[model samples]
Target: MVSCYSSHGMVRQSWDLFSSMRRSGFPGDGFTFSALLGARASSSCSDHAKLLLLLGISVHGLVIRLGLHLDVVVATALLDMYAKCGRVAEASRVFDAMVLRNTISWNAIIVCYGQHGGGKEAFELFVCMMRDGCCPDELTLSSLLSSCADMAAANEATQLHAYIVKIGFQDFLQVGNALIMAYGRNGFVQEATQMFGMIPNPDLVTWSSMVSSFAYLGLAKSAVHLFDRMLQQGIQPDGVAFLGVLSACSHAGLIEDGFKYILLMMRDYKMDPTPQHLSCLVDLLGRSGRIKDAYDFVVNMPFEADVDVIGAFLGACRMRGNIESAKWAASKLFSLKPNDPVNYLLISNTYAAAGAWSELAKVRSVMRNMCGNKVPGCSWIEIGGIVQTFVSNDMILHQSREMQKMMDLVSLVERYCNDDDIICNDPSLV
Candidate 1:
């Protein structure tokens, strides 16, 4: 009964049966505990993670008392439970204490670190796994590539690609898809396109990655071209693929194409628009100076308008100096995300741009009292194989002598250009 409940994902029922088993003096064995632990680990609700971790720890105690912790199956289950529950430290301890390990054990721990934003550590573990005579398979490479993508470790990703080619795993669809995403995330659009071409039979994920790569680089025509090619190849697009095309249209201000894709997704593919798709459409119309249309679309959306939708409308209103629409959007946004400083910032900027000083003052006062300090904008750039992040008002970076030299050089160039007729003063020519 316990196993059945756990298998079917009735976590509460599984726990209840587990307690009942203990009360009935039926001390569970390794298999029973594994089932319970697996159920807890795979619980869908993120808010239940802490509770699941506590329950898993109690089960771990029982496994130790019963001497089942030494069982490989039981140990692997425990390791996976700890890792999935965000207890990376505890998972590491379990991994280190294991007298015997398998590929599953190694993959679990590597993925644990990878999923928790420990990309560097996960790569180190991959190195350690190789040293211990455990040859990495497709899963290992894919996990490491995913971590590299998340961290934007392009240099490491390139090395992994070479490794994949050497190991003959490059032909595997999963590894191919991972490589595409990794290259795309690190701004290697050409390499991503190459990877996409290399795939003998590209799936939806592969097509989506290529389209997204083009979209990310602001090459909307190329992105749309790829989408058309994908359709010609008889590969159906999923929501993600639509998202990439829609995003390309939004960035390029191709409002008609955006609407056409939305209608096609609904009528042809029979796919309901996801929040991301809807957000892209809103952005498309908003960016094309159709603020009223975007506002109407948001108001008529089947689902409640989310932050992204409202933010898009508000941004368009700000650009067009539509004070009335901005106020309405700002009210909706405030109710949805009261603590978001961007919401307050956008509304205040709109009022200021429209020369509504009283409204601007009121918005500023509310922002000061409610939202506190505005978050500084930040950007990252990779140089010399390292990612360097800079934030607005960062005195440390600003004070750097190297930066000062660059600024001085820029000023000198500007003065020289202004003194001569070599540089055109017209905005379009410059």
Candidate 2:
């Protein structure tokens, strides 16, 4: 009963039930506490993460009191709960305290660090897992690869691929799909295509990744071709695949195809449009100068718009120079994501572009009052198989001299080009 309730996110109910059991003199074991922990871990919403962490910590205390913390299964579940709650330090401490562990235990810890942006720490733990003679399964490889892709750590991804081939796990379809995502994210499209070809049979993820890769590169026609091929092969589509298709068609201003596929996804596939799909549709409509239609669509969404959807609407308003729409979207963002500096900066920039000095000042004032300081913009570039990071106004993080020289060269070169003619003419000749 606890397990069932926990899996469905009824954490409070599970706790009440557990309290009743405890009042009856029933001392819960590892499994009972594990179920409770699983309930808290099931939530993927960031807004509720802190509250869930508090509840999970309470459960951890009970597990320790019952002397069940040493139980491998219970410890693993406890670590997973911490990981899902965004408490990487607590998860690592729990993992290290374990006296015995299995593949699942190791995978849980790896996933904890990997998903939390500690890709290097996660990779080091993978090495430790090998030294301890715990064999890694497909889950381990896929999880680690996912982190590598998120970081665009091409070097690490390549190393993992070699290890996968050495261990003969390269043929696994899931691993193959991960490799495609990693390579594509790292700017190695040829390698991603090669991996895609090696998969004897492509699944939904494989097609989605392929489509997204092309769409990201603005290769809309190629993405459409791939979608057509997937349909010919009779592979079922999912929400994610539609997201890619919508993004691709929107980028190319293929509004008809975007709406056509979205309708097909809803009517034929019986899948509701994800927030990302809605965002893409907004972008498509905006690109085609359908500002009013896009605004109406957003207003009529069955559910409240999430961050992505609102951001997309804001971007469309900015692109079309619709200050009223941009201001409305900005108001939505102020309440939805008050702390994220990106949203504040975007609205301020839009206001500045439209010559709304008072509104721009207000946004900056709100940002100062709410966030205290601007978050330095950060970006990554993979050069010659190595990924380098640079933060705005921080030169010492990488090769400061080389980057400074590049910036100087770009600033000098831009002065010679006419903005009106530059778009259609060769930049080199300009």
Candidate 3:
């Protein structure tokens, strides 16, 4: 029966067959559970993991009833299922309740925590695992490094780097790539570059990481240079690598280079540019005041333009104070996203700019008829993971007094300084 399940497929069918043909002679064994768990945990079937979780619970109840030990394979699978389900709390409970914990067990829990944005918790677990005297492995280090990257934990990242070097895992390519990502994300480009140089034979992941790091640092020239070098090394650039290169070109306003890379990606690499790539191109042209060209590009695009693509064009028009173009782009954008209050506000703003008070009134009336509640345009900046959001007039709790005091201060400051050009703060003039 197991042979039949194995021949058909590796996972679900085997379990069904095994349950149906409950041979009295066949005793439940670890190998069978391991194989079944492997099949369930394999990628591409997220639903299977959920089913496995339910089955695992039933198996656990049976084990408890019979006073049987929970096998390591079943334990790991249960942990993985909970983790993948975005139920880290349950996963942790399962992990702690397990009778035996191995390297795989620890690795699963740490990775789950990291992916779920519990970076600080993951780090604490890593330290505790080390204190427990469990020999640190690459999988453990990789998971911890990913957590550090996600949180942009520079100090923790530096310590992890030292630990990796001390453990002699720095030579491993996978570990090196993870470290590169951690350093790159934490704004340590020089350190990331130094690490990249030490990699004897870099793979696609290594090259992609370096390319992304260069792009993130706004060093598009360097990104393009490294891309050329990668091609010379016969390393094929994947979608992510191309995205990094294109983004670099966009950042530096290198239009020609941007077009060249787009052509290379499509013709040379035989890879079609995604919507994001096209949007980047439109944004590059738009921000450079080539609003007409950007508009033409969108109209000529092989696929339908998405909200993002249209928004890029509209923003460019607003930047250039091209009222005609702004109105055109705004019309299309509003049509695409009527439910969005911000789009209505943008159109009204454009109409106000053009001195079309009646059109502005018309827009506001439509908004009122549709939904009287207006979601104001708010801006936010994150400082130390705390987001400070500001709207037109509404103040945060206990901050109104301070806000009033600041307004009085601003009035005093304005009386002493008069500059018409400096009077406005909208960088996008339109």
Candidate 4:
């Protein structure tokens, strides 16, 4: 009954049954505790992780008391639970203490690090897994590739791709999809295209990844063309695929085509417009200089406008110099994301652009009082297979002195250009 309840995702009921069993002098085994832990992890409540972690810890205590801590299955479940709760360190500790390990154990810990942006650590663990004679399967490679994508480690991803091909896992659907995503995210568009081509029978995920890759690379026509090909091939389009198409249209400013696709999605495909779809529509219209229409669209959206939708509208307002609309959108954004500094920054910039000095000052004052220091804008670039990140006013880089000198030179050039405008009348000189 507890297993049934847990399987059905009735977390509270499962817990109740578990308590009742214990009260009735039924000492459950590892399987029972594992079921309860799985149910706890699957709970969809708002406070999911916090509540799930508490239950997981309790179950872990019970496992230790029952001398089942070394059981592979139970230990794996504990590792997964900790990882899901963002307690990667605790998960690592559990992983290290396990007397017996399996591929599942390694995969769990590697995935934990991968999902949490510890790509380097995940890579190290993969190497250790190889040394420990634990042959990695597709899941292991896919997880590591995903981490590479997150870190924009193109070189690492390429090496992994070579390794996957050598191991004959290149044709595997999941690995192919992960490779496509990793290559695309790392700016290896050609490699992503090749990966897509290598998949003989592409699924919806494959097609979606390829289309999104093109869209992200600003090749909107290619993205749209691929979507058409996908349709012609009789593969059904899901919300994600539609999002790629819509994003492509937005980026390319194909307003009419975007609307047609939206209508097609609704009328023919029976797909409702999600917030992401609405955001793309807003961006499309706004970028095409139809700010009023974009605002109206947001106002009349069937679903409540989320932060992304409002942010899109706010961005449009900023572009079109609609101070009133921008102000209203910023307020909505503030309510939705009170702690987000971008909202305050956008509003302040909009006010400044409109010469509303008093309003700009007020916004700045509010930001200073409520949000404290604004986070510096940061960006990263990959050179020689190493990704280096830089932040505005950063002082931690190894070549900070050289960077400062470059910045000083650029500032000087800007000041000089602004103060004195020299013109050459000779055509040859021009």
Number of the top TM-score candidate: 4
Clashes of each: 0, 0, 0, 0
Query: After aligning candidate 3 to the native by TM-score, how far in Å is the CA of 420 from where it should be?
Result: 28
lDDT of the structure predicted as candidate 3: 0.79
Lowest lDDT block of 10, candidate 4: 420-429
Write down the TM-score for model 2. Answer: 0.85
Model 4: runs farther than 4 Å from truth? 47-49, 352-358, 402-430
lDDT of candidate 2 over 44-147, digit per residue (tens)? 77777788888889889988888899999999999999888878999999999999999999999999988888887888899999999999999999989988
Q: How would you order the candidates by lDDT, starting with the best? A: 4, 1, 2, 3
Residue 406 of model 3, lDDT score: 93
| Candidate models: Cα lDDT each | 0.89, 0.88, 0.79, 0.90
Query: What is the per-residue lDDT of model 1 for residues 170-282, given as tens digits with 9 covering 90 to 100?
Result: 99999999998899888898899899989998898889988988898898999999999999989999999999999999999998888899999999999998888998988
Regions more than 4 Å wrong, model 1 = 1-8, 46-54, 64-76, 82-101, 131-133, 348-375, 395-402, 405-430
lDDT of candidate model 2 versus the reference:
0.88
Comparing candidate 1 with candidate 4, which one achieves the higher lDDT?
4
Error of 4 at 257 (Å): 2.2
Q: For model 4, how does the per-residue alpha-carbon lDDT over 176-220 read when each residue is reduced to its tens digit?
A: 999999999878899999999989999999999999989988999
Off by over 4 Å in 3: 1-41, 44-69, 305-430
lDDT of 3 by residue, 212-284 (tens): 8888889889999999999999999999999888888888888998999999999999999988888889888
